[model samples]
Target: METFESLVRAEFTPKTTFLNTASNALLPARTVAALDRAARLRAEGGALDPLYADVEACRAAYARLAGVPVERVAAGASVALFTSLVAASLPPGAEVLTAEDDFTSVLNPFHARGDLKVRAVPLEQIAEAVRPGTALVAVSAAQSADGRIADLDALREAARQHGARTYVDFSQAAGWLPVDGDAFDYSVTITFKWLLGPHGAAFLVVPKDFGDLMPVQAGWVAGERPWESCYGPVADLARSARRFDSSPALFTYAGLRASLTLVEEIGIDTVRAHDLALADRFRAGLAELGHEPVPSPGSPIVSVPGLGRLQPELAEKGIAVSDRAGNLRASFHLYNTAADVDRLLDALSG
Candidate 1:
């Protein structure tokens, strides 16, 4: 097995102290090289068959990462697009329960329907908020604002007892946290952030029965045999979750395939341990400097209140972080080191 230090050294040469994986992750050199190869193939009129194969390869890899069978995953481009499919499936006036300040993609679709009874509670109260009429419980596995992880086990048990379906968005958790797609009725995750892929790759996992979703956005790629069903209408839509697929961005898949390979090779457990250690170091440093970040134990992302203005100065000092809703957000990942964490602290202290 390759050591984590060597892996980081091999894949990245950061020009700055980058601690912003929550907004966008730095792509590995292998993934970038794959993108260049894909671009060249398109420019030189090479056969397109290999690019199509990349889509399936990426789907299978993401399925394994999410701990689901390949048949359960649908390739898509965005969380909102997939969430809208779930939103379209609900009948008018159905109740949906969610966390306060949950990622909007997990909340907005249900709200946009205007007829659904969408209820929001504190993130800590989500599991307890489930009621008899709640038809769905939608929340992010890890929050985008402060990286507070939801109590998924409690939420799942609560939804089960209340006869509500569960939908989890793993956009902030997949690469660094263990994902069990089978535990929820539906799950969606975009690969760009912690998954270290490009902007145009995402995955959706659905129950084996396909639940109540109607593939309202189905296109040529949603057909069981896409190549043959290109005319007036598809002869047969896919029996599996592939029915929800949008026409893939082939270049995106080509690069994502490589990044997923790297993730699997290093393993999620290893990534989590490395990331949380850096996060803990930063948290300790914050304490020494008389700063208190939002409590997000066991999570790699830290959001400190009343420090958003320091983001610009930090950036000018060759450090990168995010200023979200007046919070200075620093997200650590496998690529980060303790030295990097200390560098940010040193800058903040000065």
Candidate 2:
């Protein structure tokens, strides 16, 4: 396997300069080229049929990465959170359970649904909070803000016993961790946050058995036979997750495909190992600087306490980081290196 730094640098385009990837990651050269090719195809008056083919390729790639069948992969935009909401909004008056530390995007969808009651319980209390009337339990495999990882097995058992489905928001964990489809009745949703892809692109993978569960936002393309006729009566809903995919984003799929291909080439396990190594170095450096790093570790995302003013301070020195909950959040991807971590630590020391 190629070195992480080499893999990242080979794909990174110098045209666009990004300080840190945690906020909105910079797309690789392959992704840019693919998108450009797609745009050119459309500009040349190409039909949407060919574009759908490209989208299908991306769907297949994501399905393999997510450990689900292609039929279970649903293409969409930033509606990962929206898809989770639909998954949870099963029956009327059904309560949606989630962690208080969830991404705001995840919470906002259910919060806007007036008919669904939303309950934000602590991670430690999620199992106990899942009751009989609960409709869906939403949990992020890795909490976005604090980088805290959740226990999927525990949450899945809790939801299962209550006769409720579980929605695992894998946005922060998908490309970075190993996701097994058979582990739970999970509708895993993922964005390109740490996946090193375009921002608006994401996908939802629902198990094969949940196809008839009824999606509240079904569209024309969601018809069982979308291509049969533009105005025909809707046929049987798809017997897979594609039923929830109202429409596909051709351009985004092209970009995502390019990015995921690189991920596959480099291997997810290699990426995670490299990131964790860098994170350990970062945490040790921060500890030496008299700041306490978050106790838990999983994703490359690390939080340093009392580094409230570090973001701007580091920015002045050409370093970038995120400030969340009065902690400094630094994320490492395939592009980052030990030297980068050392530079960040040196900047923090000043």
Give all candidates' CA lDDT scores.
Answer: 0.94, 0.74
Tell me the lDDT of model 2 at 132. 92
- Stretches off by above 4 angstroms in model 2 are 1-5, 13-19, 84-88
At residue 330, give the lDDT of candidate 1: 99
Clashing pairs in 2: none
Q: For candidate 1, write residues 1-350 as lDDT tens digits.
A: 77878987899888999999999999999999999999999999999899999999999999999899999999998999999999999999999998998988889989999999999999999999999999999999999999999999999999999999999999999999999998999999999998899999889999999999899999999999999778978879998889999999999999999999999989999999999999999999999999999999999999999999899999999999999999999999988999999999999999
Assess candidate 2 and give its lDDT: 0.74
lDDT of 2 by residue, 15-68 (tens): 312335557666789989988988998899977776777777878888888787
Q: TM per model?
A: 0.99, 0.90
